[model samples]
Target: AGSSGSRGPSPLTIGMADTIPLAVAFHEIIHSYFRGTEESKCQVKMSGDMMLSFPTGIVGVLANNPNPAKLCFRLKNIHRLDNVLPNKQLISINTMMSTRDTTVVDFNMPALTALLRRQSEKNPTAQYFNVDILKYQIRPKAGAASCPFQLVAYWKCEQDHTDLKVDYKYNLHAMSPPSPLLNVSVCVPMNGEVKNVIAMPKNIWNGENEQALWRFTELSQHSDDRGVGSLRARFELDKGPSSKGTISAQFNCEGATLSGIEFELVGSGYRLSLVKRRFVSGKYICDSEVH
Candidate 1:
């Protein structure tokens, strides 16, 4: 019995040998990844906002290249690109062509807007390009979710419509899975002296910047969309509100990026180690009609 068993130690020994190699291999892989360097990192981020002009099918989009390094981005479901501007330095027209229902644009390093380029002096920190990916759409499609929320806002102003009784109401719908913005704050520029202030769901005031600031604290810490938030206020304006005065807001979500654009590294010998994307609100004007 002992001589027969000596041929091989046991089945347990064989299993241990096989398991050891796999565990060691995984450990080394993780160790090398966490020990990465700057050059080893290859990532892309996209930041932009969506402008919704009510009573119209069009939606305005403003996008800026995320990385400082010269990179190419393939934007899916976008209406158009900034090709007619005649700036070859910021956008590489030759390579950014795609036949599919997608727009590809190569953003050059240190990309500068036309307004910035015209000036003799330029700010290095403010280097960016303005590309209206979706200036207009025939009808807002289902996947057009660059903006996180589908905001339904209403304005009820008397005939005076200025320096008198004014009212504003808004309802923010998450639109997609990136629901419940962690920190939601809507800023409405008073454009005059704001008084007789009143707000719904608490937390609202007239800031020193001459704007009515409404912060949705409960919604900010929400697990899901809380349905709606409303506010009512009366202001004694020294001057009528500016025509350009519109509602601007901040919707920060830890779940997903607001832009709805995804990135993937498509080359060999390089793994997409990490990706970070952020979409901050620029102009969140809500109106009943596109004026």
Candidate 2:
């Protein structure tokens, strides 16, 4: 998710965040009969499975072994910003998972906010963004855990500029890379006409709608033979004073999941199946000023 805010003409601040949930449930027999087993075993299995899809194959465990412990995992290319408004400038992306079995289950997950903070401190580049994460947890019954995570990244810049640009980077080392279909729209102030718009590696252009569409059937992680996909644009100002406009984007990445958390049936003969989904959300508003 990504958003933008303008103090005068150009954007002064940009914000972005992505949230994904990792849920687990075992067969009824396992929950009832394996009650004496240490929760650490489950955590280890879930962590290992989740790391399989990560580019670096690494994740930080913020909390461990609570009745319902919370864990946060950072995703590189799974989630993206769909839309950006210069004046409104706010971004949010989310992926959720759950189980329908009526059986009582014990589970542990991540505290996304705490994990994000710890990640920033460890990475010099990320520290520059001043990112923030918000987390929410809900227990439907006595032993079930449900948590929702939100991460926000923000940057501040100058005010009187005329151009608008955004970039999206994919994790080149992911075990399974994502293929994203993207649609980007920029609203040019009536006072100024669009000068030029560009999408890296090039893409279809719609002058009538002031939009760009990109469909990456296959996107690979950064490597010696392959590179990440990104898009950017520039808007030129017209003769009149600054006016108001908007910039928005939308995209879907298939076969890419955020968390690698999973559950196994410890003592039951019943089979268990896993389902996953991923997507992005946000809008940005652009405003102009007269010099």
Name the best candidate (by TM-score). 1
Candidate 1 versus the native: TM-score? 0.41
TM accuracy, model 2 = 0.32
Would you estimate the TM-scores of all the predictions? 0.41, 0.32
lDDT (Cα, tens digit) per residue for candidate 2, span 176-242? 2233323323223223344444444455555566454544443334322343333444433344232
User: How do the residues 1-291 of candidate 1 rate in per-residue lDDT, one tens digit apiece?
Assistant: 111122221112112112110000000000001011121221112233321111100010101323222334444544322222323545553343764455555545454333334331343332222233222121222321233443433444432233211222222332223444546676666654554455553445655777777665435324333443455555544444534255555655433433333332222211222233333444444433233
Could you list the CA RMSD of all candidates, in the order they appear? 20.3, 23.4
Q: What local lDDT score does residue 23 receive in model 1, on the 0 to 100 scale? A: 6
Residue pairs with colliding backbones in model 1 are none
After superposing candidate 2 on the true structure, give the runs of residues whose Cα lies further than 4 Å from its correct spot. Answer: 1-164, 172-191, 195-209, 212-215, 222-247, 273-291
The 10 consecutive residues of candidate 1 with the worst lDDT sum are: 22-31
C-alpha lDDT values of all predictions: 0.35, 0.27
List ranges where model 1 is wrong by over 4 Å.
Answer: 1-146, 156-179, 191-195, 217-225, 234-245, 254-259, 287-291
